[model samples]
Target: MEKKRILITGAAGFLGSHLCDRFLAEGMYVIGMDNLITGDLKNIEHLRSSEYFEFIHHDITKYVDISGTLDFILHFASPASPIDYLKIPIQTLKVGALGTHNLLGLAKDKEARILVASTSEVYGDPLVHPQTEEYYGNVSPVGPRGVYDEAKRFMESITMAYHRFHGVDTRIARIFNTYGPRMRLNDGRVIPAFIGQALRGEDLTVFGDGSQTRSFCFVNDQIEGIYKLLMSTYHEPVNIGNPTEISIKDFAEEIIKLTGTDQKIVYKPLPTDDPLQRRPDITKAREVLEWEPKTSRTEGMKITYDYFKNLPEAELYKKEHRDFRSHTKG
Candidate 1:
């Protein structure tokens, strides 16, 4: 039997690298592409030896060309972290808009199914609690976070247009907070930020009195939900995340305990437009894909902490987590 060929953009980032591994294990020929803007090649370095995997050093915001048959395309390219998007807002917007448009065109050309990675940020400090797919969201297009939120919103709109007008097969995953190995230690996300502080014996920084809550899904569980969504026939957006919610203050405490650090919790002003609550109503995902997160926070955190704990000394101290020397595309 011939292997199914799939192309995954942002192929060197945390989630994209994992997806590449999953499809290859299923006997698919995987072509991995990334601009390395926020993605680290080190995450996908292990796949280099695999005969079924090929890495393309290219930015998806430009013309995307994949030779031969592409059975599927997973559009995972984007600068996901606030630190990243804030620093490079134009690139973030371009990837979500232009990059998505190009890939949707490719999917149309190939007659292949495409799944674009969307985010819970579409909810935009959501007016609705435990956001559902039906909520239209309360996003501000001009806010600082608006660059990313609106970009993803635009991505979703364009995706559905392509699906409806162009007859291209499409799926959108409204991914929530997910954490695990290969995450940049210095990324502005709460998980890595807290873990990095704990590891360095610094106080955990809590924004906005720490009353804000977020739901975190383990990476393995997240990838499972995404894969199931891609294979399913659903055409609408599906939430892929653990609905279990935790307050930032309490989550900071959890990290201190897990890292065996005696660090204190320090409070800071919340960034503009930061969401106060983020939890997915996964009723659609449960019904459509029959998927729910299976990894417990305790089990998942330990595994994640150990991964960060064992990192080389230099990695722990680097102000910037990404190293782009080798993978930068001219």
Candidate 2:
């Protein structure tokens, strides 16, 4: 039997690299694509020796061409973290909009099944509690964070259009906050940021009194949910995340405990357009995909903390900032 062939965008980033591992484990030919704008080559370096794995260092926002038959396309590109998107907002918008469009076109041409990774940010400082697929969302198009939130929203809209009008087989996974090994310590998300500070013996910075809530899904659990969704015939957007919620202040304390650090918490004003609460309503996922996160926060956090703790001392103090204007069109 011929092995399946899969294409995963953002293949050198946190989530995309993990997807590459999973697909390769299933004995499939994996084509990993990334522009290295925010992705690191080190993440997928280990897979270079595998005959089934190939890497393409190309930006998807520009024309994307993949030769040969493709059975699946997992669109996970784009700067997923606040630090990344805030610095490269235009690129973020293009990947979510133009990049998605390009991939959908590719999927149509190849007659392949495509799954675009959406985000919980589509709910956008959500007016509804525990966001569901039915909610329209409360996003501010002109806000600083809108670059990510709106891009995802537009991605979903275009994906659905392709599925309906173009008769393309498509799936959307509205991912929530996910953390684990390979997470960049400086991505500006709460988990890695707190863990990095604790490892460095610096005070954990809590934005906005640390009252805002976010639900974190372990990387393993998130990958499982995504895999199941792609195999299923569901056409609408599905939320894939652990519904375990925690406040930023309390989460910092948890990190302190895990890292065995004596660092105290320091408060700072929250960034504009930051969500005060974020939790996914996964009833649809449960009913359709029979999926629920099995990894508890305690277990997941310990693993994640240990991963960051073992990294080289230099990574602990390094700050990653990129100038994306040259690569991104105005």
Best by TM-score: 2
Assess candidate 2 and give its lDDT. 0.94
Candidate 1 ranges beyond 4 A from true positions: 321-330
CA lDDT of each candidate?
Answer: 0.93, 0.94
Query: Residue 292 CA error for candidate 2 (Å)?
Result: 0.7
TM-score of each: 0.97, 0.98
lDDT (10s digit) by residue, model 2, range 50-166: 999999999898898999999999999999998889888888999999999999999999999999999999999988998999998889999999999999999999999999999
- Residue range 60-150, candidate 1, lDDT tens digits: 8889999999999999999899988887778888888999999999999999999999999999998999999999999999999999999
Q: Which 10-residue window of candidate 1 scores lowest in summed lDDT?
A: 321-330
Model 2 CA lDDT for position 206 = 95
Which regions of candidate 2 deviate over 4 angstroms? none
